[model samples]
Target: MHLPIDLVMKIYYMILAVIGVPVNLVAIVILSRGKCGLSTCTTRYLVAMAAADLLVIITEVILRWINLYYFPVSFLDITPVCSVIAVLKRAATDCSVWFTVTFTFDRFVSICWQKLKTKYCTGRTAAVVLATSCILLSSKNIPHYFVFEPWVIIDNVPWGCATIPAYVTEPGWVGFDWFGTVLTPLLPFAAILLLNTLTVRHILVASRVRKRLRGESKGENGSDPEMESRRKSVILLFTISGSFILLWLVYVVHFLYYSIAGINPDYYKDSISTFAQVGSILQNLSSCTNTFIYGVTQSKFREQLKSAVKYPVSSIIQLIKKKQNN
Candidate 1:
């Protein structure tokens, strides 16, 4: 039997909730509790991104799946609940998308502008940037609250509940869609691409300079520790940014097409839906990859993680041994 698209979507969301939630939680905890000070700009941004991703997984992925699969009939009685879910999903997604750009920009500045980095790229600055983005994005999505409304067309029909946007026919919706897509996804993608390229170029130049310095000095067995840290951060940045671009690029292209082409609405939905589903899953999967990247690229993160895991297990072992001896 062919699996239904709704069922496939349900399974996809279930996987995201299972994997993305716990992984992001681990990343937040590890990044926050590790030796990275509270003021460390990168750690703060990473933690914020993880939190935003968790919000997206819960609201957009898991909640949408539940409404579609399990509670399709009676859930609309509480219309406000549906609207809240839509608002949160949009807000969280907006934050998650832009935060990646924010974090990448922070990395670019820290690497490319060494003089300004010390003054501007501190933990406090990171906090300000994250907070400002959150406020701005959240405020921009406030219109969604009014736009998303729950409707019940018939009695005793279990159609499931969803906050459908009520204003799609309005002339302004096209403008809104354009604005939303650009600000939320496209602009951020472009920023990351440009900033990442500049950052890479700076790193290469700095590397050559370091090599020259080493040659002049004659007998240094190790490299500069600060430069080494910058290199590690750049590698992580690339992995995260590359995954974001790969996962979202197709969806973005499709989104722009739908918004601009004015195609017959009924004509392309079936084909569009398939691509949309795949694109969504790929995008959510990117959220689950960051912690693994951190573990793989950063030796310090792995050591901290090992210690964190080992300490709890060792304590349990000691407790069990004492009980057995007693």
Candidate 2:
């Protein structure tokens, strides 16, 4: 029996919420402890990404999706409350995307530009960049709150949030929408691609030069620690950035199609609607994949994750044995 698409989406989001939250939390906890053999600056960026992903799951999936599908009536549905939630959701998503861009750039600098790496790749600089990005992105989303109006007025209170019709027609809101879209996935998409290309080019040239200098090109077998280290860094950076591109690619295409055609998604044909929905699903899934990427790319991350998983189970077993003896 074929289940309805809506039902399938609901199940998917429910599962996403359950898995996304704890995994991101685990990632944050593990990465923050600095035991993964990653540099402090890299750790800070990763922890921030995980934290933002956790927030996206809470605000977008649990609060937005589960609430919309399951609990239709709640304080969270109140227009003002829901408006704030909408703003927070956008801000969290923006920070999540932009953080990846910044992290990619940090790795690029560290790999390609040694002179700038010492200053730009420091933990202090990372903290500052993250904080500033968070603040600016959050501020940018404030206008989103004003774009929502009450869906219904019951007695004296606004019951739900509805987009103000002017949001689509008015030049100001339309311009803001364009600005937001450009600021997020669009700009980030281009930035990551360009940065990765440059990083790859630099690495290829440097590898060849280093090989000749170390006499490896002439068959004088010797291990070059510098090249080995660069290989590890390149793997981590490429995996994370590549995952981002692949996951977000559908959503970007959907956005481009609808925007270029000037068609409201609500009026899309069945096929187009399904396409848009798939894009959304993929983008939301993107929020949860970084932890898995880390596990796959970094051996130390896998070790840390295993230790974290065992600690609670081992504690519970010991506690049970002690109580039995008592």
Candidate 3:
């Protein structure tokens, strides 16, 4: 059944999200605990983005499970639930994308214009950037809330809810769908790609310059530690976000195909539909990969995680010793 597989996926997603939620919370806590005045710009931005992703994981994915298995939409008061669900889902998904874009731009600035490091990359400016992104995404999502309604299904195994027929004629439904599915993803993805490419190139040249300055001719082109690390971050982000773009691109292409050409290839309908949902869920799951990426790439995050992990171990040992002493 559709739901049986979905249920399996939900279970897997829950396990991963459970880990992501608390880790993100800790990252937020660490970031908050810092002396983050206006000067600590990129640091604050990354941690804030982490916190937002955490909230999204909890509210969107967790609640998704509750609705999917526990209470099908038909059994509940559909209006408020769907509205809340819609908002949470949109906010979380949009937050992931926008925040990633923010983080990428921040990196681009630090690398491209070193002056920006001192000038524009302040905590206050970062906050403004984040606030502006949220406002924009929310404004874009307003259409979804206005247009969607409780979809009643007859003779389906269990009543399900979906955004009501967006296919029908109206002034701007098609445009809205394309905007969400393609325009938003494409525009930002494009910006991120451009910035990331430039950043990597700069990092490479900078590394070569630094190595030559030090007269250390004992390494390969990308083997410099800092340069290699930044290169990996660029690659990781590209791979992660590239997967997301391709997945959404399929949906966008399919939607456009039907709209313009009235062609519904059965192959696309079955496979692509499942791929879009399952892949989106998995891609969302991959958001947690950033935290791990931080652990691997950023020494500070790794050290902190190590200490956090060891602290419990030490505490448990001390407890056993105290009991022995007693």
Top TM-score hit: 2
Q: List model 1 lDDT by residue over 1-326, tens digit each.
A: 89987788887777778888888888888899847432388889999999998888888777776555667644533566666677788899899988899989888888899899899898899899999999999988887766643345456432324434434445686578678989978998889999998998888888878877778446556758878778778888898889889988887877877666655333467778777677777777766777888788877788888887899999999999999999
lDDT of each: 0.79, 0.91, 0.65
Task: Compute the lDDT of residue 148 as modeled in candidate 3.
Answer: 51
Shift in Å, residue 124, candidate 3: 2.0
Clashes of each: 2, 0, 0
Q: RMSD for each model, in Å, please? A: 3.2, 1.5, 5.1
Task: Give the best candidate by lDDT.
Answer: 2
Give candidate 1's TM-score.
0.88
Clashes of 2: 0
TM-score of each: 0.88, 0.95, 0.77
Give the per-residue lDDT digits (tens) of candidate 2, residues 1-326: 99887898899999999999999999999999999999999999999999999999999999998998889799999998999999999999999999999999999999999999999999999999999999999999999999787878998999887777677667787789889999989999999999999999999999889888888888899888888888998998888888888988898888788767766554689899988888889889988999999999899999999998899999999999999999
Clashes of 1: 2
Runs of candidate 2 exceeding 4 Å displacement: 266-269, 324-326
Cα distance off (Å), candidate 3, residue 102: 1.2
lDDT of 2 at 308: 85
